[model samples]
Target: MTRRRLLGLAALVAALLVATAAVVTTRLVADRPAAPSAGPSTTPPASPTPAPTTASPTPPPGADLKGPLNLLLVGVDTRVSIPGWEPHADAVLLLHVPAGLDRAYLFSLPRDLVVDIPAYPKARYPGGRTKLTHAMSYGSRVPGDKANPSTAQGYELLRATVSRYTGLRIDAGAVITFGGFDKLVDTLGGVDLYVDQRVASRHRRPDGTMRTLSGGGYIGPQMVYEKGTRHLTGWQALDYARQRYTAGGDYTRQRHQQQLLRALARKIVDEGTARDPQRVEQVVAALGRTLVYAGGGRQLIDFAYALGGVPADRLTLVVLPGAGVSSGGAYRGEQLKPLGRDFLTALRGGRVDAFLTAHPSLRVKN
Candidate 1:
């Protein structure tokens, strides 16, 4: 690419990156189509903090100098305005954070690729449980009379369950809802992602004519994305990242989220956006407000600093190998799958811990 073209592309990419973070809020086009939400309620915007221009945050004091730290990254699919919206998790990412600087590995968990919902309330289902995604759905929509909301509890269970299911000690967990997610996207400007396939949507509407996305066939967004670089607004990016109805399904969607998040990070850093105090403050505030961090935020920053050291090429992406299939459910039919051995084996054999050991300064135990 010519220098001019490259610069333009980079600028476009940077804008898209910022857009990804800021675009966390958009009215849900269709309520039924989305997976149940982990919680309802619009997350209040976090109060801004002064951005630090110095090197990234120092890890928490005495963080386990052990090997790689497992970060349970979760994506909640609910519309934020409705508190405790129980949407099935459309995406799950397990970030294998190395001790120091080396790039971390990202393991994508297919949402439909169901696994047992650990600690599901037996009283309600009688049978014990349904799809893993329903773990939140059941927690929320079960009626206040029958059961309490599962947003916080669901997150806790997911972390515990994933660790047990995968046999990796997760150091921390961070979850961002659809609204916060949109904001984060916008904060990053916008994200440039290659649509792997045409995303078709128009299933129905009150209009006599069959309705689709705002654009054309199937309606809303372009389902069949040309296989090349393209700028995606917050809505478009979310649609691309969240939509899993493609022929490839959850696997594709999971990878797409990881890619876009990573891309957003890269573009931001490359564009010097992270150095901007206002932008940094927005990010930290956003995280604090919409995101729930099971552990310390300072530690998470330190983890980011350590991850920032790695070359992108060395970064590995792994998915717990599995498939999705429709499972029987009571209120709404659910889709589910098993968390296979491959996921565990990948963590066990991936030298993740070993890599972390190689770096000393980054290790911190609390």
Candidate 2:
């Protein structure tokens, strides 16, 4: 069998375990997706005194895993093997499941969105106004140790920053490195995505090799993603999702990322990957390596079961209207338009469905 077919055979097996076992010993860590290649630089700030730990809000054990859940998923571009390197929140997404538990809303926050990141004592970062992506780097610093950054600590501060910005209590979350994301996609064979526009990769060549730099620009045949439904390998999918130089820029990239996510989820359900025990084993092993899941004091299995009812087709991709912000002709960052603020209010009030209904343009048609 082809690698894609072989890997896709085991997708979402954990969700299937919910029906067969009450207590699953298998542990699946939460994982974030891969971010764009040309994302912002992540340099750790100066470390001060070690700050106290600020734990995320966790529900009591055995608490009902009902509807209206918010999950924070982040993709970072950090290489653990490289010492003294910090991670940046390259891709930030919020998954909101309504009370019905039958559907979900996935929305992306602009990495360049300027926001007030509160002081994180753990990283000794005082509150400041900066791009959204910096929150991860500022929070990931290892206090008193500039060489090693803590991804977990970084996540805590990011959680705090996002919660403050959106006014949503994050029930659970996961952080995944770019390599891990690549591995996860490869493990599932590949993903089939609808390319809305043609995107020429800025990083990769036609043969899937890194482009050589020449004359302050990359010189080589580009890996082009044509507009249409295409079966993308792991590298292809990651490369496609990272393109932002196109007409729509980052917004277009965000839409592609969200679409890729839905496509992966849909493939698992549509292909009946859960029935084969061997495939399940393969998928679980891949997930174990790539994901660092935080269940908010609950077990991963609980989440699997609670979310089992949600079908991939019901996953709705939401677009928050925003534009680039500039001052004195120099690009500062990004700010959400008024409509985006209204959507956040709707999310906090648990009326996102109504909000989308009233503002249909915000909902991206599948």
**Candidate 2 local lDDT, 1-366, one digit each (tens):** 222222221122121111111112121211223334565548653675657789965643224878688878877878677888899888888888878666778888998999999999878898899999889899999888999788778888888999999999898777777766665567668878889888999989988898998888998889999989999987888788878889888888788777877677666556655445565566656656445566668765555556656655666889898898998999989888999999999988988888899999988885
Off by over 4 Å in 2: 1-63
Q: Which stretches of candidate 1 lie over 4 Å from their true place?
A: 1-64, 81-84, 98-101, 120-129, 138-150, 201-224, 284-288, 296-298, 305-308, 324-340, 350-366
TM-score of model 1 (CA atoms) = 0.64
lDDT of 1 by residue, 76-175 (tens): 7665556655655556667675545345566565554445655446215322344556555554444444323555555666666567656788776666
Worst 10 residues of 1 by lDDT: 23-32
Cand. 2 Cα-lDDT: 0.72
Give Cα-based local distance difference scores for all models: 0.51, 0.72
Residue pairs clashing, model 2: 29-293, 30-292, 30-293, 32-176, 51-121
- Per-model clash counts, in order, read 70, 5
Question: Highest TM-score among the candidates is held by which one?
Answer: 2
